[model samples]
Target chain A: MKQRLRPILWLLLREYLEHRRLWALAIGLGLAIIALDLALSLGGQAPAGGLHVMYHSTRALESVSGNRTGTHMIGSLAALGGYDLLLNTIAVLFALTLAVALFSYGLACLYDERRDRSLLFWKSLPISDAQCVAAKAITGLAVLPLVYAVTGLTTVWAAWAINIGLPMTAGPTPPMTAARLVGFSALVLGVLPVYAISLTPGLGWLMLCSAAVRRHPAIIALGMPLLCALLNVFGLPNPIWHWVAAPLVPAGVGHALQSIEAGQAPATALAWVYQPMSQPDPWGGVILGLAFLAAATYCRRRHAVLA
Target chain B: MSESDIVIRARGVSQRFAGRPALTEIDLAVPAHRVVGLIGPNGAGKTTLINRLLGLLVGPGTIRVLGLDPARERHALMQQICFIADVATLPRWLRVAEAIRLMVRLHPGFSAAVCETLLANTDIPRRAHIGQLSKGMVAQLHLVLVLAVDARLLVLDEPTLGLDLLNRRRFYDRLLEHGRSGQRTLLITTHDVAEIEPILTDVIFLDRGRKVLDSSMDALAERFVEVVVPPAVLTEARTLEPCAERCVRDGYALIFDRSRGRDLSAIERLATARNHPTLADLFVAFRTQSNA
Candidate 1:
């Protein structure tokens, strides 16, 4: 198994280097978000000093029940709170970029498989179709998410540092916000798996397109998912058909939006504007992955012959 | 050698494409350590047969490579065999070195040293992308990869279709060197039989999907002789034996059967001497038999 993986890894590494544009896109998006955050930070006014009252309101019993804590309690409260806006924005941008990167990667996986002739190289090896597809899926699930998360963290840290070092205090925000930064970083890491799962359906479509299209694969590469979406939308009126179409949609969109508006207190205005859908299970993503493997195998079995 | 010495055995093998038969009832036994050339004109099912042998197709046929049924266990069977078809395309973006590395890493039997040596002979740069190389270079690279693999059976279908004369000669030289070891078996299909005739031990002539003739080179030469008889003796030769007559500018040429030791003494007693036909002439004579 280890021996067989050496070639796959080598090929993938070479591919990554060749398509340096992808990594550049990731870093570019990261920089853009940081700039946007800096712009917002600079625009806001100095915050009203409401920490004493807010701390007292949330923790009335702390002073009476514990060792007479006053200024320290307020500081801890400020350190622990009011960073939901940053987290929510970062999450949305992270998920969006991650989804785009994954879809593009998926399309490129099969497109480049034919274009690069690596499909033949891999098939010619002792590896089976399942192993080949699995390697691709693992790269999709594991490698891609880590890249997005790391880039997102770097972007956030860069933005936070710029905001603080510029001494731009926005509407009573944390004077020393390092704790909040740590908290958001941890949260983004936790949701990385969910982002990976959200992209599996797109990956499956990409795999099918890879197998079906020999020439100008990009047409099917872009068209298939849109076609499926159009079919599901048209099928929505029929009760029987809606049930069939229900499972295809990923839950991450709704969860991410809900987490955005539902932060600290549910913002009714924002929630009503964008009614995010319900969360789907991780196992659903696995089934989509299996479908990708099956499609890859079919493509390999029938038309995978290359020079 | 025992019957087991036959590395590839096919019986009642037939293949079809879109309801039309390409090859029918092909029974061929490829023995160990010999170069067998399959010759035919266009659309003669040579590629189809090679595909079936390499376990690259599935139809109503039974093919066994190294005693393993290709239909049921293609991967296992192909582990000991390598195939290079002339028309097949490889990924173009990979560098020559990258492509070689991929092949070596995957197939356990592939020899990296041989691949490097073969590339060293050609103008293929290690870092040059495959898409940038010419068609002849592609053919050379594919041949390099196929030759690098240490397989028991090597199936090459028109392996040098795109090579220039020099590269073609170099390819043959490499093939000769490889076959000189006398351990590997090769099945080559090409239109240029004369180019391959010197190295080939056996030839199988296919016409419209049927095996017209399968014979050893020496035996085929000794058995089938194209004798030129004068106009008067032509009738006598035709009478003495059921010879197929092809009109020539100078005289009536008759392809007489010499395998059964048929007497051509009477014709020779009357007309000009015989001229032994080259293998290409024999192939042309057999391939055009129905039309003639």
Candidate 2:
């Protein structure tokens, strides 16, 4: 297994070295954003009095915003930006972009093998097809996340430093609440599966497309979804049409039209998107992601077209 | 060779591309510890045949490598079989050393020492990025990677295609030195047949997606003949032998598979036989024969 992992590690290292420039950009931009946000808050306005006004007046604003205790702002500014909406927005978009970057990195990882024709080099090795495919999946699922997490933590600290150094009454204090830290950590962890879920389907499709069509994979990548959309536009009664339309239609609206005959209260919309993670299975996405990875590996091994 | 001595036995192998036949009813046997050269022009199904043996393609028949079906036992087959296409490709971001290390790590039988030795005398800096290297250096790196594996069968598809004359000669020399141990088998496909003829033990000519001829180099050298005749005698020479006649400035040349002993008395009466038909001449004869 160690022997099988060497090439994967080599590829990972190669990517890291190639995109080292991105690291500089990420840290530099992160620090710049941190400094600018801190400076804006410090320069925004000032308190009318000293410590009494600082503590009591801050509480007044907190109660008005519907939080009896406004510890949310400390973690918010330290971790995410100021507003709760902004926090969630940044959290989601950050996760989304991270996933996209990972997906693109995965694509380019395989792309290098094809463009350089070094895929033959990997194929020629004694490693099994599963090992090769697994290496790719592992890099995507494990290594990329590890790098992102490390970079994320580093940037968080830089943000903390910038906020603390600036002259602000509500600057980051030393004793952070354990609940806040734990809550924010849980939220960040919660976003992981979102990244995984977003990535798996696209990767699964790419794997199948790459194996089935040896040439012009990019064409298939862009064309397959567009073709499905066209089928929907043409009134093709495909399963994908229902899957898409089911999410778009409000159940109340559709039910009200049907209920004119029966005349009852409009039916409640069963929101598929709002399925709570605390429900039946929280790890469903994780399991599905793994299943997709397995399918991809199996397809890669059995299909001779990739050769 | 003994039955156990055969490394690759391909029987009734057929391959198609988009429902068009690339190879049909192909039968081939490659013995262990011998250098077998696959000679052909472009699109002669050489790559198709190699791909089949590597289990990269499957069709109507079976191919056995190392006594195991390559498709069913790719892991076992790959452990003993190393393949290199003539085109040079390695990750551009990798240093030459890193590529070697990766190969060493992945291939169970890879020899890091051999790879190190192969690059010892060359200017292939271990730390240099593969993209920065010249084409010949990249080819050299690929060869080093393949040769380090303790494989019984080494399949090289036109492994010197883009190499300059010096690098090409060096490649042949290094490859011959590696094969001199007489412990490994090599199957090579190349348009440059003459360049490889000196080291090849056996040769197979693939023309128009079919195997036209397969024989030992010595047997071929003894059988095929090229006759040189005065230019005016060329027309009469054509009727005497089922051969390809070409007009040289000073004299005319005719290449024929004289192993069948086609009547050549009329041509003998007019002209004398040249030294021998080289592999190139045999290639030309096969192409012309297939076309005819």
Candidate 3:
């Protein structure tokens, strides 16, 4: 396995070289979230990345301090799950940003080489089309997420530390401990693979379109789903907006926020992150995603000739 | 030679685009350890056949390269074959060093040292993106990449199409040296028949999607003769059934295709001069005959 992975690892590095703009967008969104957090902390505002949990906790802390006080506000904040909320907020924001970036990368990855006629050069190498497609898929769905996770975690963790060290007046300032910080980091890092897996449907669909279309892959990637949704809206019976239900789940974050606001459950990163995915089993969508990838690979192998 | 000794063998290969035929019933074999040139005009399907040979396109025939089905075993076949396609096909954003590094990592047969040595003779920079280079430089870079690979077969498609004269000669010199290893077979397609004629051991002529001629250089030399017949014997040479005749500055230059043992001695005795036709002359004659 190690022997086989060495070449694939290099191929992924090649993919990384080609897709830095997507890298920047994912990491940059994480940074922007950090900036938002800092601004909230400095401007004496409330946390909004995950707003309700942290806000209510802040309000409760202020009220308690006003009525009677000890150094237990930090304990109360942790009890209210403010830290986990903060972490989950970054997760949702990172997932969303990565999704947008993946959309652009997946659609362009296979098409641009064909357009530029660089496919000839790439095809000259000993690598197969399957290897080529695998490299791109891994980069967009798996590797990019891994790299950006570093940036995402650093942004949130750094912001968390800064807010506490600088004494934020309103946001959650849970008492920091090395164990707690390590535990929080573990939750976010642990979800990386599953996070990448949940991304397959959109990324795989875009990739298939990118390989199959001779021009304007984005239109097919975006338009086909829109066409379905529009058709659903006009005349579909018994189901309203059914086409909009499980579409790569860009609405996932919205669902998470709504669920949390409704007090159904704590917004564990796993729960909300998997919210847009089909419950009891998201593997069905995953299989569909893999099928799209397989089709993309077939298109690449079949249509390597210069147009 | 046996089937294993053949580097490329295509039998009854045919391809069509939309309703128009691009290649028709083409049969050619390039044996191992020889340089073969596929010489034709721009629309003569040279690129189409090259594409088929490399598995870039699939059609209604069998093409065996290194004894492997090019389409089914492309991954394994690619390990043994390398091609220098048209200029600027390398992505513009790729740095020369990056290309070298990538080939080294991806191709087990690629030698970065050999590639770098080839580049050292040129003014191309390792740090410069391919897009930043001139057309000639890009062609040189492409050649360097292909030449550095230790493969069983090397295919070049108009590899020097836009190169300057000096660089063109330099690239061919390197290609010739690479072919001299005696282990690699070369199959090249180009419109510059005159330039590649000296290096080709075998030549195939294609016109209007059909194989007009295919022969080894030795056979071609023995079978075809060019004569600058004087006005006195022009009619006599015509009786020899010359394949193509064109008026020269002084009289008429005629090309004769003769069967071995039948002899071109008649034309030799009647014409003012006779010699083996150059590949370029043969290409033109064959194309003219096919057109007629």
Candidate 4:
């Protein structure tokens, strides 16, 4: 097993190195969004009166919700409603950026090698086609999201720090502690695995399209759903359309946003978001993902690179 | 030769694209430790055959390289087989050092020390991406990487395409120096047949998806003869049924298949001299005859 896995591990590592620039681009874009947010807030464009009202409301809620560590972090975030909005906006932007990157990366991962005629070189190696496709799938599904999550969390921490330096809006400031920061980091990090798990089938489908199509994989990837929807209009049930489209909007992001809107603690929200893992739906999705992955591997092996 | 001496064997192999056959019922065997040249014109299925041998494409037939089925056991087959399809096959985004590093990590047969020594003599820098290098440099880099692998069979399809004459010579010289150690086998395809003819121990002629000729260099020498016939006895030479005929400055040059038991003495009496045909002459003669 060690010998079998060594080349596959190397192939995955190669994928990471080859596409590392895209991850850097995602992180850089996230940082630029944060910088833009800071510029706007510091330039007096922020609504200070509304922020003060929200801060008072948050303090009242914190007093009634019991003085716990999670409540303290929530109260700190609520004290600066503008910072809270910026943090959420940054998170949303990072998520959107990651989705776009993965979409493009997954669709192009197999096609680009053929377009550049490098598929011949890659095929010359001893590694099997299945291993090659698996590496790309892992890169797009797991590694990219992990990098985006880390970058997004770092931006959140930076926003929190910046908010702390601003003048308070009348009440006593919440104490900033290392433990609270660690808790927040954990909360953000917790969503990544959930996101990766939920989005695997969708990413795997894109890779399959990339490997199977002769040209313009994006058109085919987008058109297939529309075609399925058209079939639905003609009275056919389109479970495939639902399966493909549902995961496009990541379940973890939706759960996180819903928890935030409900005013739940970050730890509680994270736990709720991950609760689906124990259920049958996500496991079914995993099996479907493995199936798509196997299909992609089969396509990679049989499809001629330059044909 | 024993069955163990065959590194590549294809029996009744056929491949079709959209109902048109690219290769048709082709049978071939490449013995170990011989430099075999796959010579053919455009669209003659040389690349298709090579791709089949490398397990790059799946088609109708059985192909085994190094005792492993290419289609079903390509991963195992690849461990002992190294190939360079062309100069443009290397990824353009990969840096020189990264390419080497990847090879070392992925290929257990790769020798970083040998690769480093080879690259040290070239102008390619460690930091330079493949796209940043010249065509010759890219070919050089590819050659360095491929030669560093201690594989048993090396297949090259137009490996020196677009290279200058000097670089092409150097490339082949290096290939012959390092790849022909009596433990390694080479199967190469190129349009420049004259340049490779000297080093080819065996030659296979492919045309229109058919294997027209498969012969060792010595067998080819004994089977085909090119005779310089005087115009006075051109009719007598024609009775011997030369495969091809062309007018030259001296007189008429006639290519004959001596393997058919044709009377070479008649041609010798009617001709100025008889000599062995070069691979180019044989290729043209066979192809022209087949086309006719």
lDDT per residue, candidate 3, B1-292, as tens digits? Answer: 8988998999999999987999999998888988899888988899889889988888898899998998888878989999977767998878888888888999999988888888888899889988899888888789888888899899988888877788788778877766557488888888777788889898888887899888899999978888898888888778777878878876888988877344667778777777788888788887777777
Q: DockQ for candidate 3, please give it.
A: 0.59
lDDT of 1 by residue, B113-191 (tens): 9888777888888898888888777877887887888888887778787667777777777778764453688899987
**On residues A52-170, what C-alpha lDDT tens digit does candidate 4 reach at each position?**
32334445667787665544655566565554455565667787888888988989888888778888898888888777887787787778888888888887677666556555321
Q: Ranking under DockQ, best-scoring first? A: 4, 3, 2, 1
RMSD of 3: 7.0
Scanning candidate 3 chain A in windows of ten residues, the lowest lDDT window is A238-247
Task: For candidate 2, write residues B205-282 as lDDT tens digits.
Answer: 987678999888888877877788897787787766645767765598887667666777677777755757788877
Off by over 4 Å in 4: A33-80, A162-181, A230-236, A250-267, B269-274
Report the Cα lDDT for candidate 4.
0.80
Query: What tens digits encode model 2's per-residue C-alpha lDDT throughout A1-307?
Result: 7666665665555456655554454455456545544545456452211122233334667978877555654333444323222223233444555556654654454444555566666677776666666666655655566556555545544444444454463532342333443344443444444444444545545554554456666687657667887887888754432322222222233333233223322221212222333443324434554665576566555453344
**Residue-wise C-alpha lDDT for candidate 1, range A92-175, written one tens digit per residue:** 677687767776776676567666544554454455665566666667766777887888788767755755566444335553
TM-scores, each model vs. reference: 0.75, 0.76, 0.83, 0.88
Top DockQ prediction, candidate number: 4
> Which residue pairs in candidate 2 have backbone atoms (N, alpha carbon, C) closer than 3 angstroms, thus clashing?
none
Instruction: Considering the two chains of model 2, state its CAPRI-style docking category.
Output: acceptable
lDDT preference between candidates 1 and 3, better one:
3
Reference-based lDDT, residue A276, model 4: 66
TM-score of chain A of 2: 0.55
